[model samples]
Target: MNRKELFEKKPRIKINDKVSYCPTSAAMELIGGKWKSVILTHLIEDKKRYNELRKEIPGITERTLSLQLKQLETDGLVIRKVFTKKPPLKVEYSLTDFGQTLTPILTSIIEWGLRAAETKGEFLLDE
Candidate 1:
């Protein structure tokens, strides 16, 4: 490609050339969907089977859960394992080491949500 064409296709702005628009945007891009963070938080606690995750996270359609899990696996945040040695096949999901890096952030988010819920009268802090 010619220099002019290349420059036109991608500007010289290093920041914009990056995958994310900004630092916060990068974080959001990874886990900003309706249930991405929720799923990640659950995985943080322990590895869970697909059905277990579905039961833990209310109102998430099976399709959405499957799609989200695929996306998470693609993003290297979660690992999916399949076991086929038994009569019924089994699958499980868990966070990878890279995904574990988000624990502090997810914990903070959970704490913030709890406090917000208390203020909104949806939960009691004392309880």
Candidate 2:
């Protein structure tokens, strides 16, 4: 679909009463972004520093990573902690209880994607 058609297709929300867009759809409006899932996947392990996450996920630009991290923090899925230390200092990120709940969901998505790729003989590209 073209840009105009896509924009016109998006569900709109109403404020007070009347016929309004679905709330669940609006929630996905925030969470349904590309890098959100990948950032959450990395945090599923353990608390990681900004640099550590960058190293783990290859090919992600620093700017994009920063944006994703900020968004996740805003959504309350990830908590950012800053520590006072020596020269470089430190910042760490860990999943909140809310974020931990998404692990199984992400695992399922990964499994489904793998199966889909395998059936299409495109799984090799993932490796």
Candidate 3:
């Protein structure tokens, strides 16, 4: 499908009298977890295999990665692809077209984080 059609099919919030709860709440529901946004940040650059994701994301357990990926897939923000032609199966994860629309929001957050780190002296994991 074309870009226009893809955008048209994306989930959107319609504002009307029938609407309830804050729109921010809806966003949080999809990306509120400790690891959801982190996972998304890693995916923003390119599609990554499961092990590649684990290696890139520090402190993430195998179980957490699996669960978060499953949730993201269910929420229509991520696509999971599996290849099974060889001895070891390969699984890749990428953002859906709708998910790519979140680039602005994610980019803003990343910028803010870098600014904060400037004063905070950065965060480093203990070795």
Candidate 2 has its poorest 10 consecutive residues by lDDT at: 14-23
Whole-model alpha-carbon lDDT for candidate 1:
0.86
TM per prediction:
0.80, 0.74, 0.79
Mark the regions of model 3 whose C-alpha exceeds 4 Å error after superposition.
Answer: 1-20, 121-127
**lDDT per residue, candidate 3, 1-127, as tens digits?**
7867755676454432233255565677888789999999989999999999999998999999999999899888899999999968888999999888887899899999988988777777689
Which structure is stronger by TM-score: 1 or 3? 1
**Tens digits of per-residue lDDT for model 1 on 81-115?**
99999869999999999899999999999999988
Query: How many angstroms is residue 5 displaced in model 3 relative to the true structure, after the best TM-score fit?
Result: 25
Q: Taking the tens digit of each residue's C-alpha lDDT, what string does model 2 give over 20-61?
A: 476555545545777788888888889999999999988889
Candidate 3 local distance difference test against the native: 0.85
Query: Which is better, 1 or 2, measured by lDDT?
Result: 1
Task: Count clashes in each candidate, considering only residues at least 3 apart in sequence or on different chains.
Answer: 0, 0, 0
Instruction: Report the C-alpha displacement of residue 30, candidate 2, in angstroms.
Output: 3.3
Give the winner by TM-score.
Answer: 1
- Which lDDT values do the candidates have, in the order given? 0.86, 0.81, 0.85
